[model samples]
Target: MTSDTVPVPPGGEILRYAAFTTRPDGGNPAGVVLDASGLSTERMLAIAAEVGYSETAFLIPGRAEGTYTVRYFSPLLEVPFCGHATVASAVALAERAGPGHYVFATPAGEVPIEVDKDADGVLRATLTSVEPHVEEAGEADVAEALALLGWSPEDLDAALPPRIAYGGARHLVLAAATRDRLARLAYDFDGLAAYMTARDLVTLQLVWRESEDVFHVRDPFPVGGVVEDPATGAAAAAFGAYLRELGAVTVPATLTLHQGDDLGRPGLLHVELREGDARVRVSGAAVAIP
Candidate 1:
C-alpha cells in the first residue's frame, strides 16, 4: 500500500526510551514505542507530545521474526520518517532483544534498519532509506528563507547551490560559505516555520564543509516547534543524497557529519552511499538515557 494511503494504527500501548548518542542529557533524544500494534493517529500524536522531542519513533513487529514496523513523530505532528529516532529505537531494542535487523514501515515508505555492537561495544544502528530525490528551490522561496534566516545571497556558498533534498522527509539544504557564517545562526522562527510548513519542509539543513569528507551541520526545526535540532540523522541522510546528485561525492561513500556543537550537545553522524543502491545509509551510536 502507498504510504500516503497507509492507515495509522488506532493508538500505541508501550513507551520506551532511546538516547541517540549517550546518556539522556547528551546527543539527540527520541521516544520509542516498542510495540505499537494498534495505535491511532491522535493517540500517537498525544504520546509524542508528552515525550516532547523533535521526533519520536514507534515500532510494530513485522511479518517475519527480528523485523518490525516503525513510525516517527514530533511533538507537533507526525513525520514521514525520522533517522535519529530510528537509531534510538533500534539501539533500545538491541539492548533488550539483542542486536539485529529490523524493518520499519513508515509513512514515507519501507525503511530497513539494523543494529549491532562496535569494537568498543557501542550500540550503533544503520538505516537505509527509500529512494531519494532532490529539487531546486524557487528564487522567491530562497529569498523568503534567507530573509527569515537573516542571511543574504552573499552568505551562501556557490559551491553548494541551494536545493530541496529528500530521503525520509524533506529538508531545504542551504550551504554557508564560511565557518563564521554558519556559526552565527539567528532566524525569525515564526516566519521560517510558516514558510517551511507551506512548503511541507521538516527542517532547514544548514551546512558548512570542513574538508572533503567532513562537514559541520545544523538544522533549523521551527516547523517542529524547535529553534534547532541537537542532532539530526534524517537530514544527514538526505544530505548524502544531495551530495551524490551534485556529483560532489561518488556512490559507496562514507561521510561524516558533525552537529550540535553550538548548543553544546555535540553529535557525530556517519552516512554511506552504496553503488547500485540509491537509498542513503545513516549510522550512529545510541545509548540508554538514565
Candidate 2:
C-alpha cells in the first residue's frame, strides 16, 4: 500500500466534538483525527470503531496551506463522505489555524468549507457539496422501505414522495404525513440494513414538514452501525436538492432542519439552495465536547 499503510501508535490523540449545534450534548458527535499522516486504513478503521460514533474523520495535511486529504470511516466501514464529521473536522482545524477557508479532498470529490465565527464567537462551518442529483426510488424500493419502517402508504406525504437523493452520499428520502408518524420511528433494523446495503444507501432520511421553510428530521443509520444519527449534513444537503428538483420549494431558499430533538440531542442544520446551482450548501455550528 501507499504511505497510508503506516501504523498509528497506540494512545494517539482523538478529539470528540459535536456538529450542527453549539452545545456539546446537542448535535451529532464525531471523532476527529487532525494529524493522521502515518495512519493505515486498518488503524483508522479500528480507531473509528473504538470511537463508537456514527463517523470519524482522518486528516492528512497537504503541501499547500488550508488544504488536506481527508478520509471518513463509520464504525463498520469506510464511507465516501460524512457531513457531520466534515463540519466537526473543519471546526477543529479552525480552532488551530484560525477561522478561514479549507479544502478537503475526499473520495467523493473536493469539498470546500468556509469557517467563520458568529457574533457570539461561536464557530460555524458551511460545506459546499459535490454536484447533487436525485433519482427515482422506484415503486418496489419505496414499498420495501415502508414495509421495513412499519409504515403504510397513507403515512407518506403525497407532496414529498419517495426518491433517492445524493449529495456526497446517497440517502432514501421519505417524508411522513404528520409529525406524530415521524416521531414514532420503530423499524426492523436488520431488514432495513439489508435493503439499504443492497441499494447502496447511507441512511433513511425520515422527515416531517413542520412549516413552509422548516422541517423536523431523523436518520436511521443501521448500516453505519448506529441506531440513529442526531444530525446528518449529507442528508440535509440531499434534501435541499430533492426539494429543488421536485419543485417542493422555490429556488434560492434557505430552509431550517430541526433534528435529534426526539432523541434529546437537538441540533439545527441550515440548508441553502441557489438558483441554477446543482450543488447544495449545509451550514451548522460545532462545539468541542468537554
Candidate with best lDDT: 2
107-215 per-residue lDDT for model 2 (tens digits): 9899999999989999999999999999999999899999999999999999999999999999999999999999999999999989999999999999999998999
Model 1 TM-score (2 dp): 0.92
Candidate that scores best on TM-score: 2
Q: Give Cα-based local distance difference scores for all models.
A: 0.84, 0.93
Which regions of candidate 1 deviate over 4 angstroms?
Answer: 1-20
Where's the lowest-lDDT run of ten residues in candidate 2?
Answer: 1-10
Ten-residue region with minimum lDDT total, candidate 1: 1-10
